[model samples]
Target: MTKSEKTQIIESLTIEFKESNAIAVCDYKGLSVKDLESFRVAVRPLGIKVQVVKNTLASIALKNAGADGLEFRDTNIFIWGEDQISLAKAISKFAENSAGKFVIKMGFFEGNVVDTKHIELVSKMPSRDELLGMLLSVWTGPARYFVTALDNLRKQKEEN
Candidate 1:
């Protein structure tokens, strides 16, 4: 590739890194084009992007965005999204389902480096929307209980 093309790629990736909340790298060494494309489609709806990029360019982009420590090696497919959990879940699920073909390298979660164990933990975490729903439930739980208790008391008084 020419220098200008490489520069453009690096600039674009740097912008992506700055915009994303998390980034995960995986080795898509043996994956077929169709499989990769299908994976991309599955993740796109979740706002995750899957890109097959050259290691050196990725490294430069990552460094420019102030995220370092990722090892860009053979057949690396970079994955990222606006939130950490979604990207982590997608990558962890894909890697697990791939039966070791798509080996996960590591990740940058909330500006920190994450290993395999952390990635697994992140995959199990509920998405932001789910967490918000849970919080809403928690917030309304006591009020609901109070209203039910009042209704039952009113019924008992009417019976008496």
Candidate 2:
């Protein structure tokens, strides 16, 4: 690609990196076109973007963007955008279900570098919405129990 195009790509990538909640690096060496597309389709609906980038260009972009620790030496596919936990789950699930065809290299979450173990941990994390729902359920459960007990007590008082 031309210098201008490369510059533009770096600028655009920098913007994405800044906006992303997390970034996952993966190896897509043996993946077929169909499988790659399938991966894209799976993550896209969850608001995650999968990008195949040259390691050199990625390094340049990372350096320019001041994201130095995010560098990878091997062929890297960068996954970044919204819903980090779901993205991690998607990657972990794809790795688990794809017979090892897709391999996760590492990740960057909340400005911290994450290894495979961390990625697995992240995959197990509840999504933001799920956590919110759980919080709501926890809050409502006590109130519901209190109301039930009050209703039962009122019925006993009326019968007596």
Candidate 3:
């Protein structure tokens, strides 16, 4: 690629990385184009982006975005998003479903380099929406139980 094109790519990636809070690097050595595209479609709704970028350019962009410490090698695909938990969850799920073809390397979470284990841990945690749903359930539990009890009391009185 020419100097200007490379510069443009780096600048765009830097902006993307700056907006994203989590970035997961994966080795997509044997994945087919269709598979990768499907994966991209699946995560697109979650505001995640998937791209295969040159390691040098990606490194420069990442560094420029203030995230460093990941060593990129071989064929890599980057998955980044604003929601750290969503990013971790999506990549982890894709890695699992892709069998051995797609492998999760390391990641940048909140501008700090994190290991695969840390990423996995983050994936297992509930997402923001899931947490909100759980909180709503907890908040309504008492009222639901009270209604159920009142209904049962009315039914017993009618039987008597």
For every model shown, the clashing-pair count is 0, 0, 0
- For candidate 1, the clash count comes to 0
After superposition, the stretches of candidate 3 with alpha carbons farther than 4 Å from their true spots are none
Top model number, lDDT: 3
Per-residue alpha-carbon lDDT of candidate 2 for residues 41-152, written as tens digits (9 for 90 to 100): 9888788999898887877776665566865776678988767799899999999977877899988887788899999998999988899999999999999999999999
Clash pairs detected, candidate 2: none
Model 2 lDDT vs. the true structure? 0.85
Give the per-residue lDDT of model 1 (tens digit) for 3-85: 99999999999999999998998898888899899899999999898898898999999999999888766788889889888
- Residue-level lDDT of model 3, residues 1-160, one tens digit each, is 9999999999999999999999999999899999999999999999999999999999999999999788998999999999999989998898899879999999999868999999999999999999999999999999999999999999999999
Model 2: lDDT of residue 110: 76
TM-score of 2: 0.89
Off by over 4 Å in 1: none
RMSD of 3: 1.2
For candidate 3, the TM-score is: 0.95
Which candidate model has the greater lDDT, 2 or 3?
A: 3
